[model samples]
Target: MDSGAGTAVGEMFDEMPQEKRARIDAGGEDPPESSWAGLHADALGVVLRFLPCLADRARVRAVCRQWRDAARGRGVAPPLPLLVLPRFRFASLTPGGVLSAARRAWMPPGLDAGNACCVGSSDAWVVGAGQAGGECFIVNAFSHEVRRLPHLGTYDCSLRKVALSASPESAPDWIAVAFMIRWSRPELALWRPGMRSWRVCHHALFAGHIDIAFYQGKLYMLWKFTPCLFAFELGDDEHGVTISRMKDCFIEKLLPTTLGSTHELSCNMVEWHGRLLLIIRYYGGYQARHRVKVKVFVMDLSTNPSVLTEIHSFGSDCIFIGSGGCKSFPAGQHGGVEGDLIYFGPDHYNPHDAFVYSMRDGRTGPIFKPLPCVTHASERNLGFPVWLFPKE
Candidate 1:
């Protein structure tokens, strides 16, 4: 017999004495090889950018040691800006649901006083305050970062009406916060990303019935009294402030509006089609009788005088404001890129459910569950939802 055959025969003879013969299977298995050998960080970063949700990206890190290292190395690249949605206080949305990127942490006790309100979010950081007179805090859930702004001062009577936004064109990044002061004046504050404190600019014109929005590189203040928009640059220079009054800019002034009035209707507070928008919830039809009816409008700024164009209205029995519409406790209001998505807290639902509506995909997906301590009830109250993005 050949040497190989002889070895095999010898092995069989060894077991033959015990009345058992071992059999060799030539194609039974293949030797192991390292799966991580050729992995690249750049490729991993591309995968993370479109992960749909943050939790899934987190799962990739927990897979194994090699995967964790690869993911960590890839994560160092600047991540695309994430939109934040705040959860309400006291009640939980779901028992063990996933937490959205915004609700990752709780407001500090010092800042979470009973009257706290989350005004809005910018670039993954949230701008909130304790009602009108309460202190303002910018909370970054991801970095576990928190910074308190200067006291809003008694000038702002109705804190609920304040507007918080970041300059859309600033390089290093800065937050532009504007608050209405009832009869006196409005306060415009600037919070630079790395700055230790906020700077305030008091203006009497902005105190009138108006809405504030940061667009391009200027702060656009919509005056409901005169019904005009004032564009102010984000700097201390006096020449930076420019006032462009719209002639006959009042088209739908008679239409019922909420929080503040805008001729154009949009998703809560977002302008979808390059125009300010408002969503009017009408009730009457069978679908609207029980649930809320939605009407959307877009503003025509190209016209010599701005005008609101009614786009479309949908009556749905599905999107109830407080009922089975969402699984999480609803907090403040909801806003997003026009026609992109609509997000809100299901304040009355369990802590686990996050309600999101996407215009592009035409579907809503649950986001994340809050960590136990993060969802606990506190003196701080939660308001509506706002999209936070890094300064562009």
Candidate 2:
């Protein structure tokens, strides 16, 4: 019996062999395309982002038609990060929002959408869900083109979180979609840029409410019900998703229930001043007559527990004029504009007003710029605003 066991082990060893194991350990050789023209195109995109002005972006595009084509073609390139801002037509009845340019000093071309629920912008591509039919569309806000992606699942999906990532060195690009199943079970779904199918990711800890952010070739998601965070390395073995709890300074104190207690917390993972930050907000509570207050907090994710810091706090008095009267609302979908400036969806506290806050300026303002796409006041309901950050 011992001899048979030895023979079985020997057979297994013989099948493996040293050279095969060596190649496997070395991650194999890269394909020739890794050093191709795509790399140059990608580098040029970075140049366009940091250069002083749009003229520089155009000048670089004019260097060569290939560069121009590459720059233009990169409308959906996943490597470049983009900030997608949803602008509502100030004149429509239902008033579906239009995606606008969020560049640092210059605005990019504008794109439109129908009943967009939530948006995830990466590079120059924007992925969002439509409220009319729960359909998902992959759009290039720069090119003004929209492509329909294959339906991943149909459960009246509430896509609360969306993130885009591209493999370093011009590899494949991927889009990660996350949504809740109403009252039970949230899911993580992913699709390659050109592929039509999506694979549902299975991880025990990912089953609760969570938010997603992509950084350095991995997907970072924060569970809302708990203070736990999971990072999945993309393209690591059939792009197999492996999750590990992130240990940080402020993570221990995240306090799961705090997010839901005051207002619907708007959690965003963003790069600020060469470091990553998770921005969260508590929009305040009501005690008597629809009085609402909002507080903005910032957490530097580079440290342990992600240290939490408060930016500003403000309060407002609200009166309900509707038959239903004074109701409390949570923090709606939020978008970061101009690097540090944060924009929020409409608030019931000031139902007829639009709010914008600039962390750099340390000031909040009521939006009065007559938006061509959105109505000044909507009797139906307050419009939700989505802030798009610059992808430069």
Candidate 3:
């Protein structure tokens, strides 16, 4: 932890409401002989539902022996994903998309808010770097743990995206992959824990915008506006990290379509239930207000030349897509409806309205009303909103 960041966090804590500060200090203490301690575990579970944030629930568990036992037996349902706003503040959205009060997150020391922006997130960890250069680190949002990384060192291009093979909890085996745009082509880089520097790989075929995902120990890359797919096998030896390109795969014929008269096409890839999914997003109109659309396809790499099939139904899975990374979660597990629904939230365009799109019916509508706190005046300074799952 950086000393400055620690001090800042302590100051935030000190400024908390007196009632909240009391709860933190007393650990929600109650009379030892209070009858509330005799409440049944099932009833306690019902009470816990009202506290959505994990940190809030954790404090409730400390209220009494019975509550603690109930919390241990049946943990609180996972809270709705949080939106990471600027200055380390987290904003929550109701299932209906209404924005709630924002809470400040503990910032690690030396993380300069003015120059740093989060590039990627996975398993509750965020990867952020300084815009001017020399600052790169991984912050475990849940635990406020910080692990510094080697500087990118004049890479000559801005990092466009990043993906982690596994959670920081996985330790030594975890791998970090970063994608950069250089000379109108995608450049891939890899960094593992304890490595003094990142390994850059310049592939001839990595042209245009690209999305990368790690599935079953291999890195998969998909270029936008094209049906071609590339796979790379990653390894380590005395020579450090190695990336070897595998055979190329192609999707069925589907030419890129223009968004009205303009030519803006973006695609992203995600792994769900051992399968790879590709999503293409189309945007149209001017900067003030634009129309957005999406197309989804699933790829089967086991076939001789690989097969890309248009998917109509997602079945029991739902996908959360944003600039951070596209992720699939079991709908039932996350209190979401199953079968081909795509959820879109705030992104680079500063569209604070959230929507749910149905592939089954080909209809799209607003899922949540615009958040009150996210106004036009504050939009420019805000970071891209992403779906953040709670730490297990």
Query: For every model shown, what is its TM-score relative to the native structure?
Result: 0.51, 0.49, 0.76
Q: Which lDDT tens digits does candidate 2 get at residues 1-392?
A: 12133222112212222344345437583223322345477777566445423324544643433455576545431121112223321111010121222221111223224345434544445455654226666554433356566664565555554565641113454545544343355666766655556666665666555556665555667553333555565553454433333332345365445445656443434443333445454444322212323333455565654665664421221111111111111111112113333444442223333444554444555333443223335312212333332233
Order candidates by TM-score, high to low: 3, 1, 2
* Top candidate (TM-score): 3
What are the per-residue Cα lDDT tens digits for candidate 3 across 206-317? 7646667888788888775554678889888665676854767756344334442463455677887878888766656435234666777777777876667767777756
TM-score-better candidate, 1 vs 2? 1
Q: After superposition, how far is residue 384 of candidate 1 from its true place, in Å?
A: 3.6
Q: Rank order by lDDT, top first?
A: 3, 1, 2
The per-residue C-alpha lDDT of model 3 at residue 367 equals 45
Stretches off by above 4 angstroms in model 1 are 1-50, 62-69, 72-116, 130-134, 144-148, 155-158, 161-175, 180-211, 221-248, 253-279, 283-290, 310-382, 389-392
Question: Lowest summed lDDT over 10 consecutive residues: which window, candidate 3?
Answer: 6-15
**C-alpha lDDT of all candidate models, in order:** 0.41, 0.41, 0.63
Q: Residue 195 lDDT in model 2?
A: 56
Q: Name the better of 2 and 3 by TM-score.
A: 3
lDDT of 1 by residue, 1-392 (tens): 12233222212112111112112113233224348535676776666555433345545554433454576645432222233333322221221222333322333446563345656554445566666566777665434367666665664454433344442333445554545353355555555544444455665554434456655455565543333445565554332322323233454563445522422222232443244554443334323222233454565655756666665422221122211111111111111112233444333122322444543444555533333332345522344333333311
